[model samples]
Each structure stands twice: as structure tokens, then as C-alpha cells.
Target chain A: MPILQFVERDGILDLGWGHPRPGLLPVRQWQDATRAALDAYDWQALTYGHSAGPQPLVDWLAEHLGTVDALTASPGEFFVTAGASHALTLCATVLAAPGDVALVDVPTYHFALRILRDRGLRLVPVPRDDAGIDVEALGALVDRLRGDGQRIGLLYLVATFGNPTGLSVGEPRRTELVRFARAAGVTIVEDDTYRELGYEGAPPASLWSVDPGGPVVRAGSFSKTVAPGLRLGFVQAGPDVLDRLAGIGYVDSGGGLNHSVALAMATFARSGAYAEHVARVRAAYRSQRDALVDGLRAGVPGLDVPRPAGGWFLWLRLPEGMTAESLMVVAERNGVSFAGGAQFHTDPARGHDHIRLSFSLLSPAGLTDAADRLAAAIRSVAG
Target chain B: MPILQFVERDGILDLGWGHPRPGLLPVRQWQDATRAALDAYDWQALTYGHSAGPQPLVDWLAEHLGTVDALTASPGEFFVTAGASHALTLCATVLAAPGDVALVDVPTYHFALRILRDRGLRLVPVPRDDAGIDVEALGALVDRLRGDGQRIGLLYLVATFGNPTGLSVGEPRRTELVRFARAAGVTIVEDDTYRELGYEGAPPASLWSVDPGGPVVRAGSFSKTVAPGLRLGFVQAGPDVLDRLAGIGYVDSGGGLNHSVALAMATFARSGAYAEHVARVRAAYRSQRDALVDGLRAGVPGLDVPRPAGGWFLWLRLPEGMTAESLMVVAERNGVSFAGGAQFHTDPARGHDHIRLSFSLLSPAGLTDAADRLAAAIRSVAG
Candidate 1:
């Protein structure tokens, strides 16, 4: 009756989606955090919490995450959410409306696209370069759209380690883009969900840091670092902007985020375990990313594998004649699974030759085997 | 700026809202649950769970909650959400659309009204009697609205302890309402957030249990029974309907509900401690409710307070010549805070003479103090 149930019965590797790997989940850590929260807070932990977040966690996150990037906000600016996805959805609700146009990257995070669509907004897809969303093109597009009599609603960009592509928009683009958006009377929703697992050097200044007039809203999550199951994320924006989002949240969940998750995140942030935990994650994923790239390159000579800088994926352009759907069938038959390219595309059918492989879920040994199987599947399909 | 920060700084007691008192949260139980979850499961908990929910929580809730009302659901039929509010929002998204008319009772929850407005739906506010939403009037309204060429959207109702009203629609009306909805080809979003806080005898038969094939989606929350801070709730609907909502959830939050929250809810459900805990909550709220009613009735003799059947609220209809807003100022000056009833209505000005007092946050002593303060405020305002 509903669309959610229909296609779900068919099993997919789910690499098409972004969720924390089981191995990366700090189960004991989260439990310890939650238990500590419960024991310390009593029934109060279960009742309700501050609309922004529980104080300790927000304070700790503000302090700890500051060392990772330039944060324009103190703890007071952060509002916790059910997850990053929920945070984005709230942003969509507060910022976008029917007939309004939001500038989004082409082949963007599908969920973000869905958020805009669900909010009844017109999504203007801006072309992106390898470094990240192409600023020149974005400027031109905004100008062209305006020239064509369109009113740009807002600008949404994932600056660091974006989903599906794992490409970070460079420092120059982040600054210039925010500036352009400010000039164009657009607010920027900067999503930094994957900024923490930095296999690369330090991240550039955040958009929030550069914009002082309250045009930038930054949302960060603990999902990629300590554990995704915790489902804790926070949005930092101008107080006035945040208040509107909070009003929507007050309506949405009475509160958007769970207090226990906040407590656990606080514990993790306070203990400074997130840093060490995320470091280990980066190393583990680095090995996996390398292995995946090497395996694809060696096993499938014609494939083009873009080695992700920090995240857990290797986006591969399949060999000529090999469709992701066909390869998926072959892989499934061979007892190995990875996401088909189509799942990531706004238009699923057009990206049949692309595949997303996650080293995050596979062991070193499993990676070798999976790569071999995947290569065989591709070869069979291509041949 | 993030939305909540401004609201937090405004120094508003925010009693106009439904955020549970943080002091009542069940932190220890959640911590224990999370800790156990950590030791027992790994990536399974971290990665994407089933769209409906973690199987254990769903199964446990199905068994435990079934005693309250029979639920005809397979695993695929249940969908977890951030909270009851999220469930209702999804119902609005999937079932109602722009140009559609959602039939609501007058003096309904304001946020639901906002959601309907946000979705561009026409709201048909049917008048209500003290007994609850007038079923006969609802049927006529449905016919009248449908006759006027409006597509009847979903029937959004809160049956077990309604918000603001603190009234439960009687059983006969509940059954008749379901049948009426079925005949009209309309779906019903049954919110039971306060079901566990019943101060009276057996509650009405939930639409989900009474009419299996009718378009009824049952939403239940752990916020009232256990703690609001966990932000755990679920929707029980037909498999197909649940699936469609889940599909939107995939875009909303990779997964709808937080895994840790789900785990906490599961532990709370399976521990056999839930019933006792809920009974304790009910007993505590019932005492507070009685105190609130007594105070309002005696302290402000001319005020009309329909004895609430359950829930933590006492809605007071001010004596003639007094307005809720003006009285609220006096109450605050006297150090007692309550939400002016106007805030709960789509048209706040129309409810200027009504007030909503939450009894859950006040202890026996506090309730007395509040009552005295309220009495003085009403006297001053009336004079």
C-alpha cells in the first residue's frame, strides 16, 4: 500500500546507503555512556531535555570538536537532533517552502534532495567538480536562474567528505561559496557529517566561522566518529535561525533528539574518546579504502576507482559494458555485495555503470575475496 | 542560528509546550539497556536497522502493548519513529496533500494545525463537545466538506488523553468514529501518547484494535509511559502503509528511529519492569491531576474545569471577564506559570480566556503553592 514496503523486500547490500558499519560501532562505549547517563541523571534522563541539547554534551562537544575545526559557536548554539538526517530534515522544514528554489549539488545526497522535495521546494541542481561543488558553475547557475526570474530559496552544501562521492569541497570553495550565497541573499546549510574521520590533514575553516551575519547553519554528527547507533547530531546556527528550527522540532518530536543519545554523546565527547576512536576508524577505513582501490585496479583493469581521502568508500566507474545492476546480480550470486551506482543517482537508471564499494564493512581478508568476486562479476557482465 | 538557542534564551517556562520534565527521565534504565545492547550486539546495532524497528523492540512492544489493545501486525506492519509527533507528521506527508482537507477538532493541538498549514492542506475544524470530538458533527462535517468538492484528507485525532483538552473520546464514539471514517474512505491517525497516564477506568478501544482493515494508523509513545527523553515511538499500520512511511523515513534519517533509543525501549519493554513503572507514572500523574483540578475548582470557583479523564493537563476555562494571557502575566508575577490556552489553538486570540496547567511537573507542595498563586492572579485579573 505504501512505497516503503514494496521495494524493501528485495535485499540489497545497503552500501547504497550511508550508515555506520557494525565493526566500527563502539557498543560497550555507548552502553557505558548511556548507563552513566541513566545512573547519574535518574528518571530525569528519560523525561525531556533542553531543546538545543543536554548541557554537558553540548558543552563537551563544543570544547572537543573545536580543536578539529574552527567553530563559530559555543555550546549555546548547538541543538541536538535524532540524527544528522533528522537535523537536515528540520533544516528543510524551517528554511524551505513551496515554490522556493534551493541550490543543491548535482547527484547530491539523495536524502537532502528528498527533504527539499518533501518540503515542496524547487531543487536547482548545481554541477560539482572533483574537489567538490563547482563554485563558478554555482555562481553562474544562481545568476542564470535569477535572470530567468527564479527566487533562490537557500544554498545547501556538504563541504567535507560528502556522501556517495566522499569528496570534500576545498577551503576556497567553502569560503567563496558562502560569500556568494551571502551576496545573493541566500542562507547556506553546511553539512559536515563526515569531517571528523580526517585521513587528510586539518579541515578548512567552517562556513559558520566565516559568516558572522547568521547566514550559515552547520550540522555535525557523532555517527561517523564514535558510533552511529547513538544517533546524536547537533545543528549550530544563529540563535534566531535556530529558534525557528527548534519551534518546528518542538512540534516534530516535542524535541528532535533523544536525551539518552545526548547523554551518551556527552560522555564520549567529555572522555575525549571520540578523537582516539575516530583516529582508529580513519586508519581502519584507510586500509579498507586502499585495499578496495588496489583490488579494483588489479582485478578490473579498465575500472576507474576514486580513492576517497578520508571516508569509507571507493567510488568506481565500472568497466565498459558492465552495468551496476547486472554486476549486483553476479555479485549476489557469488556471495559478495556492494551498492549499485543507480542508487546514488537522482536518476538511478543513468548511473548504471557506477558502483560504490565500502571498505568500512569488510575485513582485510574479506576485502580481498569481495574484490575478486566483484571483479569477476564485472568481467562477466562486461564480457 | 540554530532554532532552540533563541527560545532557550527567551526565559520562557515553555509550559505552552509538551516537553516532559527532565527530572522524570529514566536514565539508569536506558544506560543499562544501552550497556547490555553493547555487550550483546556489534555492527548489527550500528548499521541500518529494519525500517519498522529493531526486531526485538518491535516484537517486545507487540507482546507487551498488546495487552492494552490487540494489534494485528506482522514485522513489516510496524514503523518506528523519533516520537509520536514524527509519526503524525509522516501521516500528514503520506496521507494528506495540498488542496486536501484534514478534519480536526476545534481547540486542537496548535502544532498539528501548523503542520497542516505547512503542508498547504485546508483544515476543517469540527466543533467538539465536552465528551470529546462530536462524532455526529464529524460525520456531518465530513459529508459537508466532501460535498463542497474538498478531498477529505486523513482524520487526525488523539483518542487516549488528548493534548490541551485532557479528554478521551468515549468508547461508543470511538467505534462509531472508526466506522464513519471507513465509510468515508478516510484514514485515521490515532495518537496515543498519553495512553498510559489514564486516571480513569478502561480507556476507549483504540481504532487499530477495533477495525483491522479500516484505514487506521496507531501511534504510541514511550515518552509518557517511561520517559520523553528517549524520543521513542512507533506506528502500527497496514504493511503497505507503514512501508510508504518508511520509504520517506529512509530519506528523512537513513532510518526513522535511533537504534540506541530503540534498544532502550526494547530493554524497557522486555524487563518486565515496564508495567510497574507505568503504573507508578500513572499514579503519580493522577494524584497531581487531582490536586490541579481541586485547586482550580476551589481556588477559582467560577472557572470551569471539566475533570480530566487522564493525562497531566488541567484545562481551565476562565470566569467571564478574564483573559488567559492577562491572567498568565499575573500568575507569573505571583511565581506560577501556565500556558495560556490561546497558544494551543490555531487562532490563539480566540482562546484568550482559556488556560492549560500541567500537573506532572509540580509536587504536592508545589501544586498547592501554584494553586494559591493562580487563585490570586485570577482574582486580580478579574477585578
Candidate 2:
């Protein structure tokens, strides 16, 4: 058994991790894809590849985004990365210098915030409502930072099926965000890692699609849709941005981030196995989401559980006066665990009353059971 | 055919790239390894893995380094990276902030220079003789920089079979360099990527191994020994350094740089296939190196070609009045290509009389033909 399996075997009913459940991973398809990739390519498959990645993969991605996601990006705009985090790191490297300020959603993807901060960008969290990042608030923040002589270099947003919050910015808000970024002269980085894994219908039009050739940079990943193990993702930006990213010393020296694996994923994409796997995963996640929501509503009283249009999470605002910290203690005692909302907050105190539950890694039945346990925990905490 | 095969199919004899020859790549073995990795491991293989990379791979690497490379390092000292360049980048990110000084060899690996410079480090080139980087010069340079109030953050060296120059530091120099780093309070980053590729025998002791627990960071890669496309490498540093690297938000958020690939490589290592493959490659490289060296000696009179103890390169100093640039023009016209020594120089003008030839990617016959063509081009340029 792998170490993770051994560690996770204690049956804690984990709802904190957002990894796709095991049943959703298409192991057999990947086996075929790996075999086919090896058989199809020569030693070039194992040699230093193009810094932008395999051309076939790049071309396939362009077509897939255009036809499937309705995001029309040319091959020149795309550069393969190790994953979404890697792509974000590349963006941070190019768009912002150390000490520059990046405006992010208040309760953003925790890791996304970490990635940006790690690159030495000062993250200024902009508040968000049910619709997503409040565009007006972002504009005000950008103006305030600029007035203070702070260089607002980047605007990072998980615009579609956002992590932790499960919020998708409406199409109009995406356009507004892009407009605000353009006016502020800041590059808008849209992390669309969960875009393809929407449990409902497709998420809103990507910020890149809404404002093509604008300052919007879209980062897409196969991690959520296909398999995280592949560590394959791509960034779509304007020609100038693409050139800048491609010229980074890391890519220049190492060639593309991940070569053979990218080709294998390309094989998977070209063979249409990728789309098939995504569809299966989407259906599984949709059911898992429904089960969790239904169980939560049925078991918990006076809980505010917003129905996520799409994405992996169900954001729960606990009953008034009940802190997530206090409830989490009760929940753990009752054999359930979840990501504390405080972990996602830029200001930890702001998220004390909420919790983020990820249904992606649990079965429908598992999620239902988790919901019951969490409800009991909440009641115990409230009492 | 993959794009690389098409690009390389042209009749130009490329003596510049240092990739393993196609025949030397263990394609069948990797296929088996991939299958075995997936079969032996559970769903954890496809999930976000431990931030420090799979523990098994880390343990295996520790054992391999101790037994095979004669370098003793605990697992805590190792942090897996995407590749040697990635390892170097991480070292740059942590050891030196931007504007810090990194002392490097004058005519070093061009890409190494680029990776450091890309991280915004001020690279100070210290002179090097045939025995690799001059320890005395490095110490003097450090003293000067410190006196100037400039922080000397890192001393980067490819100690074993140095790239482009193919010069390995003697054991005594390794100790001297480590001691100097300790005295100067500067971190010594010993890039030992080519250590295992020694044709005749094992290379000199790694700087880290020479002075364990000293201020030495050793970077190793399977790129040369196994395959570059795998994008796998490791840095063996003190526990503190490893912890800092592992704590980098990029690694933490991404759950390790490349998990599945690392696991796959671990499977390859544990299976004994890696040892067999390395031995086979070493023998092939030895023959190719001899062929290139013999052909060059026989074809070109008064040429200064140092027989490398191991590694991929044959560094050549042309006869008087023959610049590498002028020879390269004639060589390309005659269907041969080499890395002009100027490309490796900190100041391009200094390497006008030098050139680097790599035999790792060519068959013995190919190397012989390339050498003959190169000789003809040299004669043409000399005239």
C-alpha cells in the first residue's frame, strides 16, 4: 500500500481534502494512455522537450478549450506547467516583483494565497459576496494601493468553481473584474483549476474568454478533471505574457516543466479519454454534492448552507454564535473533519462562524454520513 | 514521430546537447516501472502526495546515495525537485534573496549561470583551472565581496565532471571549498548532476560528503543517469535547509514537486533496473567518449582536448588564432555543431579560443564522423 493509503486507513471521514474520490479516477484509461504514449512516440518522448511543452499537447489544448470550454485561445498563448500551483508561481515570477501587491479574494484558495505570498507578493484580500469577488471593492482596493505608491501588480482570482467557497463569479462580474484590472493596469490571473469539474452545468465564462487578449491570464489544470498525479497544467495569456513566462530561466534551462507526462496526457486528450473521464467524474461529484447538501439540510437546524452552483465545496455558515473552531472539536469527536473556514480567511477572525466541506473526496453515502456527524457536532457546540 | 525526432532528423551532427543517446535510454524498463508503480501502489499514487515527496523514494535515494554514490545522507537531508535546474532554482530562492552575490566558476554551465541570474543573483565569476573551481580564488572573492559590504550568499559549483568544462574537483579541493564556505559563512551548492556518469570510475567525493554537517548543499539528478524527461532531481542539504525547502509554499501547496514520477522512479530504483541501466549507459558513454577523443586527436593537429575523467563533455582549446565562433561557422557549413566556448564564459570574450563537444547523445560512429567534420572546419577556419 502507498503511504497515503496507510495513513488514511484510520477512517477519519475526512471532508477537508478536495481530491477527487478514488472511484472517480480513471486508472484503466491512464494505463492505456501511458502504454499508447510510449508506443506512439520515439525516444523523443523521454528527451528534453520544448519549453512550451509538446506541440501536439499544446495544439490539443487549444482546440479543447475552444470547442469544449468555449474559450478561444491560440496555441501561442499556452505554456504547460507542472500544475496549477506551478503555473501560478510562474505568473508570480513574471507579473510581480517582490514587495509588489496582489489583490486576491478575501477567502481565497489557501494554497493560492500561499503560492503568491511565497513569491514575495503582498496579498491584499478584497471582500466577496455571494456573487464572487466584489468588483467595486477590488477597484477601491487597487486605487488605495496605487495611491499609497504600492505597485498593484497582480489580481489573483479563482473565478470559476473557486476553492473553499465553491463560488463562481457571474459572467458580468468576470467582465467587470477584467475591466477593473485593465484600468488598474494589473494583470488578472484567473485560476480555473476547478472549471471543468463543475458539478452543475458549465461555470460562468472564463475571465479570459470574457476579455480575450486583455490582461487576463487563465490557469487550467487536469488535476481536478483527470488526475492530480499527472501534474499537468497550462497557462493561457497574451502573446507577450506567454513569451515572458517561456523565457523564465527555469523553463529555459529545463525545457518544459514535465515532458513525457505532458505527452502522455496529450495522448489521453487526443484519444478523447480525457473528456470521457471528466464526464464520469463530474457526474460522481454532482451526486456527492447533492447527498451532502440534502443530508445537511435534513439534519441541521438553522444552518445557512448555500447551494453551490458548481465546484467541490459546500460552504456552511453555522448557527449564530457557534464558532467553527468550537464546532470542529465536536465534529472530530463525532468522527468527522473539515477545513476550518479560518484557514481560508486572509483575516482568520472573519471566518470563525463558517466551515468549508469538500464533497469531492467522499462518496455520496460517505458525504451523507459526514453531514450527519457534522450536524450533531454543531448541535452539541450550540447547546 | 514526436517533434524532437523530426527536429533532430536533419543530417547536422549535433555535438552540443548532452542528452543520453536514444539506445541508452531504458524505455522498456520505464514502461515496466510505470506499470509496477501503478500496480503496487493504491489510489495514493494518483492523489496529492506528501510535500517532501513519497517517503519511499526519499528513503531509496538515501540508500542509493550511501551505497552507490558513496555519499551518506539521511532522508531528512533530501528534498526532491523537478530537476537539477529546479533544485538550483530552489537553492537560489532560499539561500540568497535577490541582489545577493553567488560566486560561480568563470566558464561554468551556461544554464546554471542563467538559472542563478534569472533568480536575480549577482553572479561573481571566480577563475578556475583544470582542477575545477579554484578554491583560493573563491575565498579571495568572498573576502572582497564581504569587504565591499556585499553579502556573499552562495557559492555554486558543479564539482563533479563540471558541465562544458568536464573538470572534477580533487578530493582535497572539495574539502577546502567546504571549509572555505564554513569560514566565509556562505552556502556551497555543489551540483553533482554528472557524478554517476563517471566513465572510468566513481568521481571525487561530493562536497557535502567531504564535510558532512558543514555548510554544503549537494544537488543530484537522475537526468544524466536515467532520463531528463522524467524531470526528477534531489537536493541533499542539512535538515534545516531541507525543512525550509519543504516549507516553501510551492512544495506545500503542490504536495511535492512531482509525486507520481518520483514514485515511479522509486519503483525503478528498488527494482534493481536502475543500476543495470546506469551500468549499460556508462559503458556506452565510455566508448562514445573514446571514439570522439581518438577521432579528434587523429584528425586535428596541435589541438588541446582534455580527456575527461567522466561525464559527457570534451572541452577543447583551439590552436592559436582560431576562435570558436569562426570555427563554428565553418563547422555548421560542414554539417557539424558544437557549443562555442564563448557561450559558457561569464564574459563571452574570454572563451573565444574554447569550444565544448558532447558525446553523450551520439553513437560512436556519429561522434567519429562529427569529430572529422569538426576537424575539417577547424582547418578551414585556421586557413
Candidate 3:
């Protein structure tokens, strides 16, 4: 379908949208932040701004990242984007040419794959295990592609709290991956959108933080932590990389992404409201994740569901002989819905027996009811 | 110079930023409108939205276009964009593949040309006259390109109150251009960014309005009329064209451009605040344009300064023996700045004796002073 059908149909418990639930959105906080921004900045808030974004926001973001991620970055190293998806699009344009090859995790964020492919970059799938992308396998694939006379442009990974899979690469593995990429002369684009949404404990050090000053471009978004409709995110890279990105005609011509909104977010960030909101949402999602995991385990026998420490999803391995597509049919019949894992895979056959359920978009009660419906559907499908 | 330097320096009168003057921006109105929107829509304003945009904003834009442009279009005919530049980028991607030919007006909006070229489209400059893009020249260029076994993918023009020229294509010419494009199997992308900012009377019928179902795609921006930082704009096209654009991975994956901002704009539009703001900005720019034209004519004898009835710029043909480059050096020495007309031209040599003066970013007194400085610079350069 040309348009992704994401409308919540009546009576269907949908777990497909990988976004925060409506109740978790910080509406009042944002309104106040915007008002404060407009009042303080006046028309400057509404003017066409620098392509890197407003200086205050850029400065604040740099410091904020240092405080939270233990990563020190110069102001020139940051560029605000419309969102992480937009950041990925910009990276695809600046980092690689149309015919270049990008190495991506097999069960990657589907839309990230779409964004890269749309830029005409060929994607080579690198298989992943529970520890995240298999670094040795990726290294071998890079060498193989090089042997075939192919130029490997970029290595894309959801290095922290990955989408759909919810696996984070360990710090040592991240270091190894970065070393391999630098050795192979491939740029690494770390999708860090979910890094700050840790439910149980802190996620591992980001690939960018682990190998600062290396060829790592990290993309982070406010969608998971703040609000998606704001369409605000940031890309952090070395000065050289950022300069190249800032030179893209889209940014150069338009003078930055989401300027007024970015200014409002800066106000929120400075006022300590953003952190508070993120904490509240993180707590809510943590409860939602617990409810979904506990309820699904109790309801469905022999279903291997992994508990994600951060991010939105819980990856469920279907019982042997029960395919995700078959379960989806029964789930839909029972008025429950989820993203079939096949959608996340470059090769659909590899993920047929898995499904990705999001705990971020439903209430705790709604999640429990969804689990019950899903269990009932599974029993019917097995029969 | 990969990043455009638009920073306003001390003690310099800059006419380089073709944006509304600070005092003219409707700060209070926007603050109120945003507050109202947040109160009314709450979390819906902050959630991930549809790829085409929020339905209310889309519907309002369709109706607004119908009322203002005398065009009839269904909601599906409009797609929200970050702004006109982003819209142009999206159109470049959807309408033509890389390495295809795009016939653009010679002195077109420079950023439009940049957007197309950045997408790897080969830009073929078609000469334009006072009336607008020279239809005969464009036709010949298309035919010549086709004769060379190349595809003429699209014809790009700033049909209404064109940037750097302020020439609107008459209705008859618009019809002719659309017919020619349709006959030649080439799409027409009319940048109507400044259409609504007409200072004298309403601008001519948009190319899309003139031929609603033809291969005409009209791009309009609230950036000029409302606020640039909102980053809101829309592309009006036949349902087929819009569907194709909406199907682009950029839109399908990101869910839409600037959703919360669009919703807030819709509220402002529905409340009639947007129209009032446009009228206010138009009046201010009109006076500024008039002051510039009068001041320059009186100061620099025999200079041909065309008074723009609408939009932001005044195109001036320098007196013989005075190149825009020489004038710019003298003007900069006198603490005044303006865009050398060559910057807008695909072939720089064609516009060396011309300069573009933007009255959009300065007060009447500031513009008058700038005109005096420019005239002094011209005289110095002539000597």
C-alpha cells in the first residue's frame, strides 16, 4: 500500500505502531515550552534559522549529550534533523552514492532499510544474534564484498536497544564493530533512537561514544522519549562528517529541519521539563513492558519472549511449527494485531516463525487484554 | 561555502535574506493560535500522524486553495511538505530518475535548481523574459533534448511572482505551458511560493488552477506568508501525481512532514488569523518594495529597476559597463549587501550586469538607505 494504514480500527488492539501511547505524550509540557520559547525568543523563533539549527539548541544538545551519554562533541558535530528517519535519509545521501553498498542487520528497522534503498544504495544483510549484529560475520561479509570488487559504503546498526529485536551490542562488541568498520573503510551509522528509553538499566555505551572521532555517525530522536509529532532529532558525527551532511542541498537550501519546534524543544530541555517527561514516559513504558511480558508468558506456553531492557519492542519466537503469518491470521480474527517479524527481515523466510510486539503504544490493561487475545489466537492457530 | 552564510553582521544593511522583516512577523497571533490548537487537539497534536498530513490540515488546505486560487481539488490532491524546497526535492525524486533532464528557467529560484541538480538531474536552462518562462524557448529546448535521445523529465518554473524576477505567467501562458508539457510527456513543477504574497492585486491563476488535471504540480509555502520556522507548505497536483509523491519512501516511512506544525497552522488558517497575517506582511513588503524602487530610480539615474507587484525581490538591470560583481565589491565596502543576479542564473554570464534587491528583510528606511548605498556603489563602479 502506498500509505501505511496505521489508523486504529474500532475494537482492534493494535501493537504495530512503534510509538509512545497517546496518554504518555507530554502535551501540557510542550504547550508550556512552546509558549515560553515564543515569549523569550520573539520573532527569532519563527525566522529561517541556520542549517545546523538554532545555536542555543545546538549548544544545549551538545552539552546534554555529554552529560547523558558521556560523549563530548563540538557544536559543529551536531545537526538537527526532522527526525531519525530524516537523519538516516540525509546520511544515505551524503555518505554514499547511489550504487554504493550498505551493510545492514538482517532484522533491521524496516523503515531504515526503506530509506537507504530509496536512496538507491544496495543493502547487504548481516545476520544478528541476541547480542546484536554478529560483528565477525559482518567483518567477513565486508571482506567478501571487497573481494567481489564492490565498494562498501556504510555499516548501519541499531547499536543500542534495537527496534523489533530489542538487542543492544555490548560495549566491547561495539568497539570491535567500530574497529572493523574503520579498518574496512566503511562508515558506521548508529541508529540510537531508543538509547535513552532504557526500562531496567542503562543501555551499553553507544557505538559513537565508544569510538568517538572515528567514522561513526549516530542518529538519535525525540520521538520515543518526547513526542513523534514534533519531528525533532539530531545527528552527531565528527566535524568533517557533519560539514558534509550540512552541505546537502536539502539542509543548505531549507536552512535546517523543524526550526521553531527545535527552539521549543530547547526551551523544554533547558527548563528540566523534558527530562522529567522522559522519566515519566520511561516508567510508564517499563510497566507496559512488564505487563506484556508477564501476561504473554503466563497465557502462552512455550513462547520464548525476550525482555528488552530498553526501547519499545518485545521479540517473541513462535512455538516450533507455528509461523508468524499463521498466528497473524488467527490474531486478526481475534481482534488483535501486531507487526509480523517477516516485515523486519531483508529475507522474509528467516523471520517467519517470529513476531514483534510493541509494548510502547498500549495501556497496561490494553496490553494484558491483547496478550489474552493473542494467546487465544495462538491456541486456535495451533489447533 | 557549502553552508550558506546568512548571519546578519553588525553595521551592514543586508538585503540578502528574502524573508519577512522581524517586526512584521505575527508573534502574538501565532502564540495564541498554537495555544488554542494545543488546548483543542491535546495529544492528537503530538502523536505520529498520517503520511499525507493531518486530515484536518489537508482538508483545510484543499479548501483554502479552492477559495483563493479558484481551483477545485479533493483532499487527496494535496500533500503537505516541510516547505517548498522540500516539496521540490520530493518532486525531483518522484517525477524523474537521476541522469534525466529537467528544463529550468535560466534565472530560476537558485535553491530549486540546486534541489533538482543535487538529485542528479541534468539541468537544462531555458531562457525567460518579462512575461515569465519563455514558452517557445522551453519547447525548443525540450525538442532538442529529445532529438539527442534524452528524456525531458520535467520543466521547472517559478510561475507566480518569481524569485529574483517577480514575473507571474499570465493565464494564457500558463495554459500554453501546461499543454506543451502534457503533449511532450514532461511534468511541470510550478513553484508558487510567493503567489499569495502579491502586494498589488491577486496573482494570476496558478498553473495547477489553470489546468487542474494536467501534468502541472504547484508548490506553495506558508513560509513566505505565515512563518518560515513553521516549515509548512503544500504541493497541489492531480490525485495521480500526489499519490505517487505520497508513495515515496520519505513520506511513507516518516508518516508525513511537520504534523504538529501543520495542525497548528490549520488552526490559524481556520481562525482567519493566517489571512490577516498575510495581509499585514504584504502591506509592509509593498511599502518596502515601493521605497526601494523610488529611492533607486532617483539615486541611480538611467538604471532599469522593475517594480515588482508582488513577491519579495526587485530585479535591476545595471547601466551599461557596470557588472553586478563590480557593484557588489563597492556595495560591500559601503556596508550594504545584496544578491548578485548571477547567483540566481544557471549561466552566470547572462546576469553579470544585473542584481536582485530583496525588500522583504528590511524596513522602509533601511531599504532606502540600502538603495542609496547601492546607487553610490554603482556610480563608483562605473567610474
Question: Please, what is the TM-score per model?
Answer: 0.90, 0.96, 0.97
Candidate with more favorable, higher DockQ: 1 or 3: 3
What is every candidate's C-alpha DockQ against the true complex, given to 2 decimals? 0.42, 0.53, 0.52
Q: Rank by DockQ, descending?
A: 2, 3, 1
Model 3: per-residue lDDT, tens digit, B286-313? 9999889999998888877888878999
- lDDT values of the candidates? 0.70, 0.83, 0.83
The digit string of per-residue lDDT tens for model 2 on B281-336 reads: 88899999999999998888777777898889988989898888888788988999
* Clash pairs (backbone) in predicted model 3: B51-B255
| Candidate 2 per-residue lDDT over residues A128-181, each given as its tens digit | 777777888777877788889999778888888788778888767777878877
**Candidate 2 ranges with C-alpha deviation above 4 Å:** A5-11, B5-9
Best by TM-score: 3
Share of native interface contacts recovered by each model: 0.44, 0.47, 0.51
Give the winner by DockQ: 1 or 2.
2
Check candidate 2 and list the clashing pairs. none
Error in Å for residue B118 of model 3: 0.7
